[model samples]
Target chain A: MATLSINSVRKSFGAVEVLNNIDIEVEDGGFLVLLGPSGCGKSTLLAIIAGLENSSGGDILIGDKNVNDVHPKDRNIAMVFQSYALYPTMPVRRNIGFGLEMRKVAPKDREAAVQRAAELLQIEHLLDRKPGQLSGGQRQRVAMGRAIVRNPDLFLFDEPLSNLDAKLRVEMRTEIKRLHDRLGTTTVYVTHDQVEALTLGTKVAVMKGGVIQQLADPETIYDRPANMFVAGFIGSPTMNFLKGTLEQGDGGLVLRHAAGTLALAGLQQDVAGFVGREVTAGIRPEMLDSGDGPASLTGVVDVVEPTGPDTMVIASVGGQLITARLGPKDRPRPGEPLTLTVDTTAINLFDPVSGNRI
Target chain B: MAATRSRSKLLWDVISYVVLVGLAFIAIAPIVWTFLTSLKFEEDIVTRTMQYIPSRITFENYVKLWNQSGYPVLVINSLIVTTTTVLLCLLTGTVAAYAFSRFQFKGRTQLMLGYLVVRMFPAVLMIIPLFIIMRQVGLLDSTIGLAIAYTSFLLPLFVWMLKGFFDAAPKELESAARIDGTTRLGAMFMVVIPIARNGLLATCVFVAIAAWNEFLFALMLTTSQGSRTWPVGLQLMVGEFQLPWGMLAAGGMISILPVIVLFAIVQRAMVAGLTAGAVKG
Candidate 1:
């Protein structure tokens, strides 16, 4: 296993800049996932780390050695691509053993390593079959086998589970995590999948528009987002952003809007600087509990979506839509009045114009 | 109504077979006529009515063409030139084709367009320049000179055809090979080329056939008995005074036999390659 460090790396393709001053480092055996939407340069950064594409400026160190001039083959890194990218002409055995053969490992040794990997991946029966004959999930295993057999300093996965169906994707995601646990190799996985990022990564770097928006552990990234973009991008059912003017009420501080004013008396964050200014309140869907108490806010339900475990009710509060993931039993009807008690401490306050968290 | 439809279908099937049989006969008529003429006595070929059958058949024409007429030497020369051209085009053109398909070098599109423009011109248009260069290089009246001429004309088509194959083969395989510790060129030959071998084989057959049946450059560049190809030798036998129809027919049969055999061998491979999804959906 090896540590990977990117030092202010930047990349440009002629005049179109792809990555702008990217800086991230993962310790030995740490799983660092670079997560972002498409066109966010997460893949570009992964490619730069692999030494497949050169960075326009700055340095990359793999295992404490500068790899700016090293070739991908010499970098001692194996990558699993989104397409699987298995060699179609060769059988699964040779596909898994290719890197060992290229490194000039003895035939007997290569055969043994190939066997071990096949058993590990439960692909011993598929050794003689070509990649075309294998199903999508089997191909994915063989691709993983190809990477793991080499036992390189680092493993790179470029959205490796994105091609499978939803059910298979979940199965393969768990399998990948199990493999990482067993191998304990430093790995950098790039994906736009937040669930994969949350489940698989020891550290997650949320990227957007060629910049790292937030780099933290998954829990921290989900709970304390760096900005409005991170708060909006990371969560499912999405966090509701309520536009309101912060005011000093008789009781304490409150956020007043077209919806009923929300009490913010015991907020952990200091809000004295902008008592009268407008701010956006970010609240998670689950944090809004269904209640008809005096403290609860009333809103008209807009849409109801059942997701097996919970039912999501999209409701308009003060003319703004907010989603609440309540008990599946609480299947609120459209146009019905719904009372939701907000979690005061869970509110993530952000400046309206700057989108910076306060 | 169903019974009438079935009866009409039978009629349509009969008409289709008749038309197909008629087309097939027209296609093979020349070859059948040539084979029959080769077996016939010289007297039967000179008849006023086009003789469909000869009362007497003789092997004398084949025997004479194989011995006295230098027909064997002409056949050997054609084989050498065509085989050499096909090999030259397959080896060098595949690499160029792979580059054109995969790499994004500056002027790559322009260079490919230039190759296409060269292909658009008639081979006859290049004959004068090729002939002058052959003479300047002192390779005139040689099989190698003829092979070189064929290579110049056929390589562009080989490169163009194989580029389509290489493009269809994913670039990710080559990238995987590179990461697996193979050089760029090594990955191309060891990985990319093997996957695309059927296309290369198809191109090889086309290049060989184009060079084999070539008459214009073969006629102009090589006038000697030592280097003359079968088509040139056959035309020469149709003398200004009297045509040796039987001997020329025998030589024509010899010229096309190998190409037919080659196609029979490669047809299965090309079909298999097309169906095998190199990139799965």
Candidate 2:
């Protein structure tokens, strides 16, 4: 139940910078997720906070005290690794009790804490078994149980669900969310999965190239990403971008692409000054509709993917492929001429040169 | 068609068995011959033509060698030296290995390279200098001195091998332990050591075998039965013209028995431990 703050942190290994000028603060009992792709330095940041790695520069404050020089044990943080690194030689009970033993907790208290964690994690029956005897999901829970038994100031998870199969990952994701809600421990989780970030984090820090691109709540990060990178990274069936120029047409400004001109319906008021300049128009897959109406863009269907609830239609307009997520029943087959109405209000405009949302 | 395929498969299997059996016999014959020779009488051992089996089986050579010569004292001395060396190698090796595996210290690479150089040096090259140092230190003919010398020669190897073992062990486990409030050293002792049990056993057995069979240093450094290891002591059974084959064979069999027994008990761990460093998951 303590807030963790990382201020202006930087880390380097020899000459290669791993983390750069990173600043993040997790409120008391808040779930903060650091989300990035592989080699993006999320894990390094997590390790730095956990005291498993030293930062080249910056202050790490855990509950108001700067912990930059503190040992991992003294920092009072518990981490569940992606591997669920349970002591293979120790039984489940001993694994859960090890932290308490290290802290010199009384035997009775240690047992009680272990029992409570086991009960909370619903792993009481697994107490006598070794990690090798447990299934992956069970091992994951025992790893979590081991962390909970310590009841440290902060709980750190490094892609804890990534090791599980798809269904198990989802189940454990929910379990972790529920566990966080119940315990209300300030947690910093690192994962490359955007969905996990969206689902579990109260605040998500999106990173790339060893730098924080944006940090915000899930909804804001999705709807109003700070830059093109964040916008492109946060969505599935990702947002389609059309390289075009904004020009004043018949009635108002329209985006002129290679294929055809798309009338700027509601965007003109916000983007009036960018006329005749090149810009990248961003549109989500779901914003493209099939019904012909005002503000419609005509294209030929290239591919249709039915994903049970919806159909993802890939349409080529002016030789550029655009994907439209539409109702499964309304999807046009390949080679069919289709009219997709664009939702201009949800359109995002980025400067083509700098990739900054204009 | 199926019959032809089955016939070919059977033919291949027969060839495989023949090749394997040939190799096995080639490997096992010496050991079997040594065992039988140790059980034959002295007169029967010197027969011009070899006999696979003896008319008279006797334990007399073994008993005579054990009582009449310094063979018993040599065996005891070898055991003490080997056991002591193995234990000390394990102690120093485990600590140095843990440090090498887990820490990011100044000169770590240089230190590892230094250890590799120590292991790479031929044992024969060190014999003279070691003998001189031992003589100067008044450690010339003592089992304790031999054990210490053996440990110095063997420690680098044990450390090198065990460091590879420890390096293969996931750092996440130790980090988890430390995060759980264990000190760095405590995490190593409590978590790393337990997980590395197979490796520790493998290293101990390797060091024991190395110490048990060491002959050059023992011959160069020790003078009498007080420090004479089994390999050196067994050579004493040989004469210029007439070799005491039965007694020498018996002593060799005695010297090799404990190692075979030790390997048998820990064979699985040894194989697994040797291969542990190559794969991560």
Candidate 3:
């Protein structure tokens, strides 16, 4: 129901600055995930948005009005904490209704809202149980129910599912996306898990060392990262970087590595300034396949890691070590020469000095 | 061989039990003796023969202590003074503790260390200055005056112990409460305080016990029954001429009763809270 905008927000704690000129505008009903590694200031940004922390210098707007000085409760936003921050002493029923009660809602109306949220989150049976009595997944649902019952203009989540087990984290991830689709309240979620950012966010903001490296839709963040940091951070078997200088081939520009040269014929980025300069060539592990593609790199397989669905191939190509993803059925043993096909269209180039994409 | 090992283990257990039981008996013998002496008549208590048990149990000693020594008035004064001291100390100490736990202001570490230093000082060393302050305020012999004096001494210890507990309560919970629509102070009272209930309960019992049994300040600050606590009255019962053994023992037992009852009621909570914050709900 509200569009959230942060403009030139800078946060500093005495001598150390945590966030520098953070600006993001989440359109009405947009899901923005602040994605980064640990100490990336993603959680800090979320806290500032929720009014739990004050920005040293900035203006925050919800819809049209500035909410910089507004108290967290008065800002009409609900938050789900990473720890699930449920009242330890209160039963699930009261925990869900606490925000409503704080707002001075009528008891009957509060009960109805609580019931609605409980039913939505499928936690009706656990309503009478204290948080300590519930399992991790159930506590997560209660945390969501607490936020959902508020039905506010925006929802803020601070790594809410990061504490769950891998399987449950996936289940809760899908549940959160489903919830967002149903409610459509503008939401800002923070997580270090790139998979979560890709699956759940409509837009992803990758942060590093208190600065946002990239801000765009998930696919854009994955497929066309603005910098090398985003490209490396947003992938699981993270992007493989090969150091070399850019060269012009007979047909067009090409990235030359010590191992081999990759044709940049289908490269989407402009290669003008990067003509003869040293560059870091990057490609996702998945983009390198076992079969012949438009390009190929012959290397000796160093190790083979079979992870059920896919086999990870770590091979030494020339002097640089590169990893590739292959189908589980194709078993390539270590110490064997393997010629993995590379997809030139999926290649990325970063300036060797700046670490930014060229 | 297994049978021989079992016998040896059993022998060790029996020896350990004998040692433990012997230690326990030694610890309780004095208390038991005092109680027995309190129940005996004055004649029996003063007899040359060491009377382990009262030949004639009498309520006369208890009645004399209760009515004649002005012990009832002293007990009443102690109750009012200690209760008032506990409440005020808790109120001010909790706020100080919460701030110390959550916020880092200038000199916070030094200030906290200063409180710890004050707590370590012997109470007698500060009594003279306290006496001067009491005289200046013209509150020397009043129970209210005694409570205020107890507050000055107890607040630092209360803040130190309770700060450790309040620190155990996650800062995230308080932040959650604030976002849930309560002010910071409101969050402290409603959310943080409730979660730290067991720790708070334990701290309250300790504070109350400390104030109730406080001797030095009570001795110097209070002059008469209007402000005198039980410990002072008990000391008076040990008159310079000769100690009233029966009355003294009765008064000592009475003094320990409240602390024992308080621990009995809240021991589970105190123990439970000790390990509560290990894993969060």
**TM-score for all predictions?**
0.95, 0.94, 0.94
> Relative to the true structure, how large is the alpha-carbon lDDT of every model?
0.90, 0.90, 0.90
What is the DockQ ranking, best to worst? Answer: 2, 3, 1
i-RMSD per candidate, Å = 0.8, 0.8, 0.7
TM-score of predicted structure 1, chain A: 0.98
Across residues B80-152, which tens digit of lDDT does each residue of candidate 3 receive?
9989999998878999999999987999999999998987888888899999999999999999999999999
DockQ of 3: 0.80
> Per-residue lDDT of A13-48 in model 2, one digit per residue for the tens?
999998999999999999999999899999999999
- Candidate 1 has an lDDT of 0.90
In model 2 chain A, the worst 10-residue window by lDDT is: A265-274
| lDDT score at residue A313, model 2, on the 0-100 scale | 93
Which is the leading candidate under TM-score? 1
lDDT (10s digit) by residue, model 3, range A1-358: 7999999999998989999999999999999999998998988899999898899999899999899999998999989999999989899999999998999999999999999999999999999999999999999999999999988899999999988999999999999999999999999999999999999999999999999899999888998889888988878788998887789888788777787777777887887977888998888899899866657887899999999999999999887889998898978989999988888888888887888888
Note the chain A TM-score of all models in turn.
0.98, 0.97, 0.97
Q: Which consecutive 10 residues in model 3 chain B have the weakest lDDT in total? A: B272-281
Per-residue lDDT tens digits for candidate 1, residues A38-139, read: 999999998888877889998999988999999999999999999998988899999999999999999999999999999999999999999999999999
lDDT of 2 by residue, B246-279 (tens): 9888988998999999999999998988888677
